[model samples]
Target chain A: MASSYSIILAILAAAAAGLVGAFALMKRTILAGDVMSHIAIPGLGLALLFAWDPLVGGGLTLFLGILIIWQLQKKTELSAEAAIGVIFASSVALGALLIHSDEALVDALFGGFKNLTPAEFAFGAGASILIIVALWLLRNKLIISLFSPELAISSGINVDRINLWYLLLFGLAILANLRFLGALLVGSLIIIPAAVSRQLTHSLGTFLTTSVIVSVLSMLIGTFIAMHYNLDTGATVVVTAAAFFVLSLFKKKR
Target chain B: MQPALTVLNIEVSFDGKNVLEDVSMELGAGESLAVIGPNGAGKTVFLRALLGMIPYRGTITWAPKTRIGYVPQKIDADRHLPVNFKNLFAAKASILKLPAADIEEVIEIVGLNNNIITTSVGHLSGGEFQRGLIAFALLGKPSVLIFDEPTASIDVAGEEQIYDLIHRLQDAQGITTIVVSHDLSFVYQYATKVLCLNRAGVCFGEPDIALTPEALEKLYGPHKYFHYFNDSHSDDHRTKNHDIQQ
Candidate 1:
């Protein structure tokens, strides 16, 4: 069950990381994604206490965080980053207070994928697959919105509605990846793969393809390494992604 | 014929700082209107208000079933964005449901090489990039086209070529064009009507009469030079030049 869950997670993580990651990176919402995941830590702690699926808690909390950030920024003139900063500070302070137990803290931060039940596995698989398909189907409009929002509006795309929908899906994708990448590093898993792929290709198709391939390969390799050496799963996976980013930064001869 | 677009009592304020105030204009079908202003004179604000992109207290009435094609002041894109003409064309085809023949016609009209469709947008030269963007806007098959600083990056010869192409396109297709530019020379050559936009609407009328020294002084705070068509012919001939006096 454990290995099967890891396999499912690795596959879904690849697709979600590549697809959602591209949107996150392009929209300049990488920081917001990272900060939202961090804000989910306390939710995970509460979920553990209640013996609930931690992803549920994390997803709910992340959604709430998005609303708080959006409203605060909308009602006031606070920049999105500044709004996220304020919420993030309060979130971390609350997370630190709630996550008193060491095991819960480790699980929240490092993500233990070794004990996922069949039900949890199915939930993760379902959510991740849904996100992947949604992204694939919405690529054209999403690309338009990301590239030139004014064009999107002029072309009759509801830019605001699309933005809100994308944000909600981002929260869900982060939740789905929380099994292995953990709340602390899930956003990085998404960002690193897409960032590396961006440096490699000049065509959108090639960029997306490279992102997915690199992410899948990294997840599988990191899983193997963690299993063999008894290392931290989340940290090892993120390190593998970072390695890909480093490799992509090398200049090829013109 | 009734004007294709009408703006009444238009005003835009950002954080209580007035960007545009009590501005109004009427654009007729098949007419080319140039919006000329100095930098920071709310020309962009005026354009965005027309596009319905910003909040403004105004009534912008468009003729029934008027489809507008918009080209923004600047395309906010990163140097590394993975965009090729083919991809952009494909996206346009999907969104606008344009036929292949119509799309190819637009590509030809914009004077872009058919073979350049495979090249990435970032790699295209400044002139080529402008042509490509114009091609993209043409895909909408709009009755009206709005351009913001379309010649900002092009060289002098490239600018002439673009304005010539625009004039030819307008003549061929009878599309209403609203252009925002600081190039008084090009605007004078191409514009049938002109509006000098400042915080408050400075002046609006035919190009020859609207671009008078008084309006120029008010909009630009005493310009060095300006040229207009000689009053004898009432035609677009850039032969006459004059200096603004205090």
Candidate 2:
């Protein structure tokens, strides 16, 4: 019964992470998250190598990802998307090379859902709550900056400052959830829920709210199904989210 | 009295090529100015430079630190962008951090009905979209308003309505206005000053004094439209009378 409870806790953690990811996707720029996830892998490998928690390594990875993107945006001709792509591909290759000899690869790639504890569940919930609060506080500036940056600037909004905060929040969200979803599928988690919700509603507020709800529900369903059927938790969760996206698309078409 | 805006020796270039060369103009508070030019004459570029959207090589000083509102030529709304009037209003409210009531006031002033505010901005007719943009611009109670061919996509009646709105806003708020347009007939009534621009800084001011037959011939250069210049003089006379009554 305790094992079953742990499984439930793991699903909740995954869902909270998924919700953060969804917010990133709704902003229409999740390439940055992708880069952070890749950079996180090497950090994870190094953490395991040094006998440290992988989440600590993931946090360092997320920070590096944001810093690198910010530096490239300032000094290079390459856009944020291009910079993220370069970082994402290179970091993934580096992580594969670094973790080749360790057993960490199995745990990192498939995720060890069995190892989730109540403390981790609390951490995940706390991170999710923090992300949501930050987004709420900056919602107006973020939405305006997204739609028409020039208009926002003209209206006396400091556009550069807003953009900096936006990138920072994006990095933190990816850092908080890198363990459950893995680097490969973290971006999909953020993008799929928002995209699916967008298909369901025309209102931006409704779309955002529905995305969060969908993310949590999918996590619960996916985790339960994974345990019952002896399936991989990460893959099951992603597949469940994808299935919901497909369903929403078909419903819109009708 | 201080002029609402003063542009002194403003020069604009794109990719090492000059678009607006050494242009200077001023508009007094409550005055209307029309920036008239042919296609590819850099009118839009000039307007953008004044708005400080583009980097330029001169000083644009405004009296009393006026809030300048802008309406761009085209607002592209793709399916990916779920922009409605509420989204636009929310964007303004967010940027300005204004109360909801202020946003509604601006919406009402722009004459947008409740039904239009709820509809998607992408699905709006040309006239409706233009009005929505005007509403958006007027939200902060701007003292200087710039419209970049607001009537270009709309019907004739729509164009007249837009001009009427412009006149009403100017009269009500005493705001300085600059309109960039190729359509001379629409602007003839409202423009206190007309600026005719071509490459190499060819311009004339004071609509009646500047739009001469010879000047029109020189600017247009062997076009069929030169004959229309003669008719424009008589139309200008009628327009002057219309402006007096308004």
Candidate 3:
């Protein structure tokens, strides 16, 4: 059975994921975000080894990874996927090497249903709210940059700084859910809902709203089903989101 | 005709290889300058350099308070993207803190209707998309407009319309226009000055004077098209390639 705090944190995280995913899908960075989630694995491993707070450790490495990827993208002019590729492989390998226990490894890969303490819940909720608010404020700039970076620059918007802020927000979104969805499955929560929303809508305003709604619904229903069936919560959530995507395919967008 | 832009011996290089070297040009206020060259002739590079999108080793002076609006050759917009021109315009408007009236004004100036602007970008026709880009560039009341191949993807008839729109915008708004174009006829007709580029400044002056057969051959290499410009042109060849002759 899931605790109330876990459910609340999961819902908040899902909302953030939905918002982030909408932009990531448009920016064509959804897949890169998947790989970005894995960058946290090494940090989780180090935390587990040192008996440190896993979220903190994961966040440190996730942000470091984001900064490195941002710099690589700026300096090397590689696409986000190419830059994420440079970091993804090594991070996963290091994580695998450091995480000695198989159970710990499994938990890190596909999250464990651990009851959250009041502090953990607070931290998670704060991060989720920050992601939502920041993305809301940045949405207009994000839209322009995703549409055309050159146009954004010509508009006097700093494309690089906006990109950095987005990447950081993307990292923050991943970090907030790293405990709930794990490194392997969390990206799907972000990607699938937005994808489903895209399939159903043809306008930005509705697309964003639909994605958040689908994401929250998936999290709530997935939690209920997982608790009832005694199934893995993260997997159940992802599978639920995937089911939405499958259904969206039937309603062909005009 | 006070100079709106003055460039002196600009050079741009990437990875130790020079893409543009010793290129120079000048543009008077309200002048339509056409930049023409064969593919990979640093035409886009020159534009980027002027726009300050890339670092260059020269002085480029734009008259103070000169705002530039750019229309790129193409944007590989994702088909599934749920953004329309309205969303895009709103986004830009919000970013620049421009009033909504400015958006309405640009939409009217570009002749884009509410229906077309509201349609998803992926669903828009090539002409519609081009018009949307023009409207986008027209935002913020830019004093200068730079276009990279404004009609590269449009059909022939659409191309003519796009050229007409650009020419009209220039004339009506008195916006200093710098266009990278492949259509020599449009260049000859509309360009107040022409810059023929090929990794260097091959020629620069009025289109009729600077765009001689010798100058064009130097810029694009020897082609049968150059024969059309020669005073001793053959009627047979002109009839054969009437489009190029034009």
Best by lDDT: 3
State each candidate's clash count: 0, 2, 0
- Candidate 2 off by > 4 Å: A1-27, A31-36, A49-52, A67-84, A114-123, B94-99, B197-200, B212-246
lDDT of 1 by residue, A1-254 (tens): 24766697778866777788877777666777778778788788778777877877787788888776555534434575676887778776777677788787887888866877777778878888888888877777888777778878887788777777777778877787788877888888788888898888777888888888877878888878887888888888889989988989994612
Q: What is candidate 2's lDDT per residue for A98-195, written digit by digit as tens?
A: 78665578666556466656666666657666766777787777666555565666666776777677677666655555556666666666667777
Show pairs that collide, candidate 3: none
Instruction: Tell me each candidate's TM-score.
Output: 0.91, 0.84, 0.93
Q: How much lDDT does candidate 2 score?
A: 0.69
DockQ of each: 0.56, 0.32, 0.70
Question: Local error of candidate 2 at B62, Å?
Answer: 0.9
For model 3, state the Cα shift of residue A156 in Å.
1.2
DockQ of 2: 0.32
Put the candidates in TM-score order, highest first: 3, 1, 2
TM-score of candidate 2 on Cα atoms, chains taken together:
0.84
Off by over 4 Å in 1: A69-78, A251-254, B223-246
What's the C-alpha lDDT at position A131 in model 3?
Answer: 94
By the DockQ metric, which is better: model 1 or model 2? Answer: 1
lDDT of 3: 0.86
Candidate 3's residue-wise lDDT over B1-246, tens digit each? Answer: 459999999999998999999888899999999998877999999999988899999899999999999998777667667899999999888888999999999999888999999988877777788889999999998899999987776666777888898899889989999999877887888999999889999999999899888888888678844543442112212122111110
